[model samples]
Target: MGNSYEDECRRSLAEEQAKSLAGTNNWEHVDRERVHQDWDVLYREITPFLDGGSLPGDQQIQEFVRRHFDIVCRFYTPSREAYVGMSLFYAEDEAMRAFHDSYHPGLVEFLGAAIKVFAEQGSGFAPSAGEASA
Candidate 1:
């Protein structure tokens, strides 16, 4: 977030990475209809956490993150490493961050934390709040 060249470069790189992923053949399965329908369900599920009515690790939140992780697995690889990388892009990429924050302040950060926790639970790895996002 600093004004350094490295920061902007990171943002730009992550944006391109996200674009590349979305442009892949698997993205065909993620049509507008599917996105809209899934968003409806996801929106309902994530609202409480996003609105501060619940915490990040709440059962609903865990389920939401699990569903989110499943979506990513469906579209792409199931590697925890890849999921972690995607979370980085979601939080660090300028456009991705803006899109998620449009839903709520710190939503991307919270989502990143939740996703990383969900992925690492099986591996017994624990990450700092923004470290996975970073």
Candidate 2:
């Protein structure tokens, strides 16, 4: 059989990611391996909560979201809007969703909601409820 559609999508998304990051000086100094390592750890750390059916606003999940924000900060500081926008992208972008979900099913949606909750509460710029849903 020819390459499956999911494989093709993965290839296309890889290309798109490379193209988007190409020639961006801001990303030049990023420790990509470290970022990948951190992401792997984050993925493993969060999967259990998802598997256990915890809501995104759960305290433990929000803690992971804080770690996620810190990981992003390794490259650049993100305003609250930027953080929420990134979360939306994770949920809405096919490529990003595919990439994240590769580690665990439904990870994209879970992470997105958790990130939104974090952005609203613990991002250090906004003040909101600690238990609100995304």
TM-score of each: 0.63, 0.72
Which digits, one per residue and each the tens of the lDDT, describe model 1 over residues 1-134? Answer: 23453344345445544664677853665565776678557856685677766766767788887777655544544445446666677777799888777777778878877776676663422232223543
Top candidate, metric lDDT: 2
lDDT (tens digit, per residue) of candidate 2 on 32-54: 89999999999988998888989
Q: Which candidate is the best by TM-score?
A: 2
Candidate 2 Cα outliers beyond 4 Å, as residue runs = 1-24, 125-134
Candidate 2, residue 110: the lDDT equals 86
Residue 19, model 1: Cα distance from true site in angstroms: 14
**Every model: Cα RMSD to truth:** 7.3, 10.4
Q: Candidate 1: minimum summed lDDT over ten consecutive residues — where?
A: 122-131
- Full-model lDDT, candidate 1: 0.62
What TM-score number comes out for model 1?
Answer: 0.63
